[model samples]
Target: MDPVNLLFLVPAALLAGFVDAVAGGGGLVTVPALLATGIPPAQALATNKLQGSFGTLMSTWTFWKAGQIDIRSMLFPVVCVLVGAAAGTVAVQVIDASLISAVIPFLLVAIALYFLLSPRAGDLEAQARVSLPVFGLTVGIAVGFYDGFFGPGTGSFFAIGCVALLGMPMRKATANTKLLNFTSNVVSLAVFALGGQIIWWVGLAMAVGQVTGSFIGSHAALRFGAKLVRPLLVVVCLAMTVRLVANPQHPVYGWVSGLFSG
Candidate 1:
């Protein structure tokens, strides 16, 4: 809550919003910045959701106005995400998150590789591999729960799901990702609010930055389409993977250290 911290966090949120709007790794920036301010981890995560909601809302609105998202078709997925996020948020209060922390770096690496190697990952809409209902039940619930529980690369998860499973173009995938992400974020934010974990002033101040950044980022995505989104998605996932493993306490670091010592 120091004015000094605000000066740092608000700008971080702005940068986060820009990256998140385009490819969905905003938390990679904002969460660490929040933590660095010496807040409790729970409060930092809660405050993150509060600021992130503004960014997602702004990007979602931008995409909607641009005719990129179809809200009515997304209703079921939204409901599924809401349910999953609510459950995950509650579970996180009691569960140890170390396991997830250990596993996510590998998963992010895989995602980055998929984006990097896939010839047609986000180029165009193809035939859906699964029905909408199936996507809602599977990706919606799973990624929503992940967002509520751990929440770093949620936008990437949603965007990839929309592209690979639902067969959406990159721009449309990014648009819908924001909407579904907003759903999970709001559900998690509400639970955090109920637990009295959020710092309103900090969250609100960062939100101003988030809104401005999201507006610009969403427009850039619209302008450049796949060329912008695909590379950013790969970079964000890779960056998140590195950030996660860089933590000395992260299980991957320990595992690698043991391997080298052995």
Candidate 2:
């Protein structure tokens, strides 16, 4: 790749890491930057997973060190996510993704509305609505599958599940989200690696930026807690929704075009 591409991608990766650490949707930045560099879409997505792993790992470590994550409690959910992501990855090879793509923007909008309008969305922990085991089997697996199948809004889904079902505070939810996100990311990365889709040099170079930005962003999250996480989550979810719908080939775009033309 040209050095000029690195100039664009590295900075984008840095910003992506920062935003992703705070909330999610880092791929919103990095994927486009990679595509703009003229890499194949497969390589761009694979390379994103490579760099994203670094960012998620860094943020997870930071959260763990701060005592925000409970690894022992999270073990089952991690395993569940592993299974779900693996299944989803395999399923994607055969299934049509258009239906899922059509539905996602609406779901994202609902999530954004929930976060924006719900008074207690991320304010504080309430009584747990479900046990961790149940949460693992349901939200964990579902979101993991979604991540592997569609590859967007995953962190938002995880964070909301933690906050709403598990009754975790915003900071704690964000911490746990990173851990689970890392698990799913690694599963996808391995598949991509097996297919030899990644560009190593680009991924490694962006990883440097990912690590640095994640470190800073995680610290910022710790310091500000819910105040920072809440608004950022809303913004990230809505932005991702827009990006999805804006794609000309996206199902939502086609549906809208048909509506207007008819």
Candidate 3:
């Protein structure tokens, strides 16, 4: 990338890191920036994973240092995330992404609405509805697989699962989400790297920004609690849903366009 083009990405990556650390939606920013810079979709996805891994790592470290996450307790979930993400990454290389692309927007919309309407969704901690082993096997594997394959809204999904099933407060859920996000990201990054799909120069450049932004964002979450994080989560998910559906190649977009033309 040229100096000017590279400069354009730095601020976007920085902002993405911050937003992602808080409520998960950084790809809503960074992926578009990559595509705008003319990176092909596969390379863009791979490169985004590279920078995202850095941001998630920083966020996870910050949350851990603050005593928000229990790494030892999360080992099983982390292992599930690794296995699921590896499967997803490998599947994506062979499968037609359109298979799931059509459905994710609706799922994102549902998640946004759930948080929007539920007053207690993330505000207060409650009793866990299911055992940790069950949560790990189900939500962990499903969301981790989605993260590796489709690469958007993974954080929000994990956050909701933590809140609804694990009964963690918003802040704690966000913290734990980062840990899982980091795990899936690292696993996916390895797969992408092995396939030689990453744009190293661009990814590394963005990663520098991700580290700094995530640090600030994580601290912000620790300070503000649900008041700040909740709204951001809704906005990010809705925004990502719109971004995906607005693409003319997207099924929803195509359907809408066809209706209008007809």
lDDT of each: 0.91, 0.93, 0.91
User: lDDT tens digits, residues 1-262, model 2?
Assistant: 8977898899899999999999999999999999998999999999999999999999999999999998998999999999999989999999999999899899888888888888677778789999998999999899899889988999999998999899998989999999999999999999999999999999999999998889999999999988999889999999999999999999889989999999
- Candidates in descending TM-score order: 2, 3, 1
Show model 3 residue runs off by greater than 4 Å: none
RMSD of each: 1.3, 0.9, 1.3
**Please, what are the lDDT tens digits per residue for candidate 3 over residues 123-188?**
888999998889889998998898888877889899999998999999999999999999999988
Q: Candidate 1: what lDDT?
A: 0.91
What TM-score fits each model?
0.96, 0.98, 0.96
Q: Rank the candidate models, highest lDDT first.
A: 2, 3, 1
Best by TM-score: 2
